[model samples]
Target: MKTEAVRLYGKKDLRLEEFELPPIKEDEILAKVICDSICMSSYKAATQGTDHKRIPDDVAENPIIIGHEFAGELVEVGAKWAGEFKVGDKFSIQPALNYADGPVGILSAPGYSYQYIGGDATYVIIPKEVMELGCLLPYKGEGFYPASLSEPLSCVIGAMHANYHTTPGSYVHKMEIVDGGKMAILAGVGPMGLAAINYALNREDRKPSLLVVTDIDQGRLDRAASLYSVDFAKSKGIDLRYVNTGAMDNVAADLKAITDGYGYDDVFVFAPVVPIIEQADEILAFDGCLNFFAGPGDSNFKAPLNFYKVHYEFTHLVGTSGGNMDDMKEALEMMSKGLDPAGLVTHIGGLDAVIDTTLRLPEIPGGKKLIYNHIRMPLTPISEFEEKGKTNPLFTELHEICQLHNGLWNLEAENLILEKWNKLT
Candidate 1:
């Protein structure tokens, strides 16, 4: 079968090309991708090309498709998966595949230049390895875009689930967070940051009593506050605060005041900027856990840490690149129960615009840039929904649905979008 995809051949070399795909083997499944969300990691991979650790050494020899977060329907299921997974089954994927087991071990995932296909394509074959690793997940949700977001949301889930411990003059290490303690998320108004905030606020177990979200952009901060209101958090018996550190002359001082000088028990750094990392470290309490959640493209990216505090106060740091299958399952379950992360989507486009969208993801302001693989529309921002609605009746309906949800994307909005687009196509 012939299909279209955005393939990366080298550094800053991404091409939207049409290619023939071979028939799937008995253990493989063919999925018709509907929605693929552009991620910052994909942008990094596109810019770094073969230099990325995840990219295969033979990438130049075999250029690969380049997106990880996506959801679709099973167009063809192999005989082996007939009963287990049938054609028309809705699904998503946990791209972090750790298949190797012994001395010849190599830890890698299916996305980027390492795999034969990716989410950026109109269709992708779920290889035998992916099925064996159980990374291909069946999704039951109202919309495919929300399911596509599960990958990123799972990363946030894994970060929240990360545990740390202290040993008293001993080498033994333990894991877990300080229960009901103070937590802070730096640069917490972006796409993944918003997911973290939603999970932190809604997770029923071992949640923080006080959650402080900081961002340099007041607009993002305001949007986050509006989405997750103070009144709502108070009703849940939690203290939630959003602050724009840009307005404050001293960000560290302002953060310190928010915690009443006790410092944060758990601090999450959402941006790769070194200054943000240092600031996150500065606001840690005794035995505080600083999670460097963002992935940096630069291999030599380094930030100064207070080693004195590391030993004396027991402060430590950890980082996670992506989440596992379990984390993706949790995200799906939460979304099924009405925890919508679709609010993080700020721009929407079609497969035709994915290459440009991937190239300019960082420069484009907003949360996630959702791409409908079958559509051919230009990228549209949520903020311009009303204005766009004035001309396009489809967008007019979307505007109403989003406005009903406080200007945030929801299942109804996504369903409306898909339905309208299908009709036009």
Candidate 2:
């Protein structure tokens, strides 16, 4: 058997490569790669080559697959894993795993050494370890449920769970409110910012009195215009929802305006640019929080610190980088509940579309663009555990477990054995 994969050969160059299939181990299942989204990490890797910050320094750039944000189904399941997960189960990709099995295990040993597998392919062999880390998603139809959004959403989940301040026993911030409170979003209204926006809006026991979104791009401001649904943008005023200063004038004035001249209570610096954080320093209220949502590893990525402002004004600083398995699970839970991952997905493409779509990250500002339907059209759709049980036995198990525990697992069927026939003469 063979598989087609989008392999990057050098800086800025990508190609579709074919590889021989490997035998699936008892704890491993074969997955047909279906959906994936282009990301800034992949784009920067192409532009910066091995200089890419997201890919670890020790890893080889070329001859590697390209996608990280994706979702897929189990096509083949190994027998030892038969009771572990079922076929036809769908889930978002949770790419991080920590192998602690004495460091000599075959399952994640190669991945730990080779820097993990990428998703720009026609097929992927899912070791039991990787499957255990994925999030099982809730579905509503034969249509792809957009579970491919797990990776980006997981990043939001991490930020939400990070350093939350509170009464010592409360969630993140013990204050228990945001969105409807005075909130400042720097470089806001882009897809990434939108995720933060919605998450802040929908936070339980934490309602923001005001939601202040800022962007120099008129287009982004225009898009932020629509976040006032019942579940998002709970603030009573749409006039205060978005603001545009074109990255030139003082954004402090706009944020101050939303906060009734007092400054916002919470500020989210969604863009990685230095100047934006500077402005966040200006308009954040005393004891307010400023979160650095964007991350850049450029040599010149340093931002001038206003330590005086941070200390005197009592502003809180926080940031989150990548998605982990636990974060992915939280994201899937929100998606399962019918919450929009906040229009953060701006583009959707197939495995063949990686290079083209990746190149557009800086230009495209918001939304977590999707890739499932484009790459995995040949896949049989699955919505019910009972449905998957007819063909692959693992479906019922994975589905029941997901519904009951709000988690995801990989379902597959595989045979990894080398049986000796009659003695050779």
Candidate 3:
């Protein structure tokens, strides 16, 4: 039926739109989306996108659905998978389906191909294959507040378990992941950077001798220090020293001042900002590691990374993108252990605020920005759009079209609107 979605229209226009949904197939589960966290990547989607990452041609032509991070509960299940779920089952969905065949990776098993699913909608249909691979997180009600955080944390897990992090963890030849002994979080304080910082503190191995998180933004730097738990040990009083890489000098010197005139052991660059990397390599200690955390566009963006430093210092450079199922499990495991996962869900609002929220996503003064979808829901597609926890609505012609449409809206149990529309059409 009718689902409220945040649609991307070309370069710089994103808005909330009403749309129809296909009925859940035999291998599908209808998820009633309750909460979704707008990631930093979602905020910068258009800016970072080139022709390659553009939405598929068929989806919207102009305004295709755009949200990809979300958490919700299963409301409907196909007969074959009925035993796997029950009503009121709370769950957080892993929306990145990059390695697949279908729009939502329904038909194709996951791989490195089709990467995303539209999450800013009233309902999301999970393919049977996704559920089959343990993608559907069953509700255990174990302090999982701010379930919106699962996706972000999952990405961290993906990075940690990758060849880069794991290689260091093996301890075979002194290679170890979670190099906490003298670690630094470059551009730390932003939402994604903050996530990296939190993940680092939780790791048992590689606890940093000096946990240095730097950011040019004073506000975010303040936010990072206020975390209290992660920085209680070695972080200086969270003062940001702005570096003008345009000067092309003193960048390494500044970092030296922070690290006892020796470069840091490891650095995690949260964004793909090039100049930061120019200076990052110079300041890293011999045998240091640099982890590029954010996912940049596919247009071959260039940076002045020093391969000489990479070779002579015995250093390494690595990057990570969206999280996998293992990452989701790592996030859920943190929740189960009673850690405050809700720190990630910093901002919360509703559908009526979608435009406002999206406009502010890039500048918001918080960590995890979440959109509560059930609020300000329109009644345009009554038959298909009606949900169990949805708010009551006032009907108009548009609302009527949304609600009464039998073809899309009255998906589950038929309603009056569906019957009337079906007979007329």
Question: lDDT of each prediction vs. the true structure?
Answer: 0.83, 0.57, 0.58
* Per-prediction TM-score to the true structure, in the order listed: 0.94, 0.74, 0.74
| Candidate 2, lDDT over the whole model | 0.57
What is the alpha-carbon RMSD of candidate 1 to the true structure? 2.3
> Model 1 over residues 1-425: C-alpha lDDT tens digits?
77788888888888888888889899988889888889998998888877776777677778788899999999999998887898888999888776664111355555574444688888888877778788889898777887999999999989877757676687765665566888899999999999998888788766788999998888888888888888988877779999888878778778988888999988999999988998898999988989999888777899999999997999999898778778899999988787888678898888888888889888899999998887787898988988987788788788898888888777787777677786854
lDDT of prediction 1: 0.83
Worst 10 residues of 1 by lDDT: 101-110
Q: Model 2, residue 91: what's the lDDT?
A: 51
What is the Cα-based TM-score of model 3? Answer: 0.74
Ranking by lDDT: 1, 3, 2
User: Which pairs in model 1 have colliding backbones?
Assistant: 164-176
Q: How close is candidate 1 to the true structure, as a TM-score?
A: 0.94
Candidate 2 similarity to native, TM-score = 0.74
How far in Å is the alpha carbon of 94 misplaced in model 1? 0.6
* Candidate 2 segments exceeding 4 Å error: 53-62, 98-116, 132-142, 166-180, 227-232, 235-240, 363-367, 372-425
Cα displacement (Å) at residue 304, model 2:
2.3
lDDT of 2 by residue, 1-425 (tens): 47777665556666666787678888777776565655666676656655553443334442556676666677878997677567887655565555444122322222122222466666777666665644333333222334665567677667655634433233355432244557667787765677776666655545566666778888767756654343344343423467776754566676576567787666778788888888887787766677787878576787766778665665677877766666676667666666655255444344455555566667654455454422422222123445755765544543464444322211111000001101110
